[model samples]
Target: MQQRFYDQVPAVVLGYDNALEAYRSDKFASFPVQPDPGGVIMAQNGVWGYYGATPTAAAAQSTGSNTGLVVAVVGGVLIVLLGGAWLISRRRGARAEDRE
Candidate 1:
């Protein structure tokens, strides 16, 4: 049980020396340890767990490509303008025919 507990729980939770002491006192089982927020127990590379630093604003912003977003916005504007022009031209043609 002692070996299993040590294998399952990281020493960082209570610090190595404290963890050993807790185990000796039979208090380790009841000690509260926070769960991993990311829900990742083990990494693909066989690493015990992920301990990565939080990303900065600049790093987060650079991950995505803005080209697609810009293209979509430009395409939407062109469609609206072209539709408006077509509607105006059709109205003018109808007016000219009525005057004939």
Candidate 2:
């Protein structure tokens, strides 16, 4: 295990599996010795914030998959609204032409 210093805290990257599943097993039980893509950190009798924790990437731990997903959802809604507007305008024009 390689020692890594972060925020002046000495830490180690563990080789455990993903935390999502382990955590899913029992969130309370998985409180310590978490899992992440970076790996797992089995604390060796040391106490610190998130010590003996799992390695999770910022993206992986996010509520959403990515910022792009936010944009995609917004864009899709806008596209649907715009398409409906265009269809309505076309229908109105057709009616106007028929009246003329």
Candidate 3:
């Protein structure tokens, strides 16, 4: 079993006796054994586990694309709308210096 993909999802690299015979068959009712170190396992639908390798090269040069999370959420909503328009223009310049 090989079929790799990783950050783009879809993975399956089974080996240790076909991942313990597909984690004792029954189509993996609950197969969780991922302590990492080249013997992962997290079976379920879409099967995203059992990776021993093939995910290097800077994690396959990820271009999964969120465009840097939409340019960091549009630069954090333009720094909270320029810090709320500099605190509403310093509260309208302290209400025009309290009407002089």
Model 2, residue pairs in steric clash = 14-40
The residue pairs in collision within model 1 are none
Candidates sorted on lDDT, descending: 3, 2, 1
Q: Among these predicted structures, which one has the highest lDDT?
A: 3
Candidate 1 lDDT score relative to the true structure: 0.55
Error of 3 at 76 (Å): 2.4
Candidate 1 local lDDT, residue 41: 34
| Model 1 C-alpha lDDT per residue in residues 1-100, reported as the tens digit of each score | 6677788975635432322212222211222232444233333244433333333445455466789999999999999999999999999999999999
Best by TM-score: 1
lDDT of each: 0.55, 0.57, 0.59
- For model 2 the local lDDT of residue 84 reads 100
lDDT of 2 by residue, 47-81 (tens): 54245344445424547558898999999999999
The per-prediction CA RMSD against the true structure, in angstroms, equals 18.4, 15.7, 17.4
**Can you give the TM-score per candidate against the true fold?**
0.39, 0.37, 0.29
> Candidate 1 at residue 76, lDDT?
100
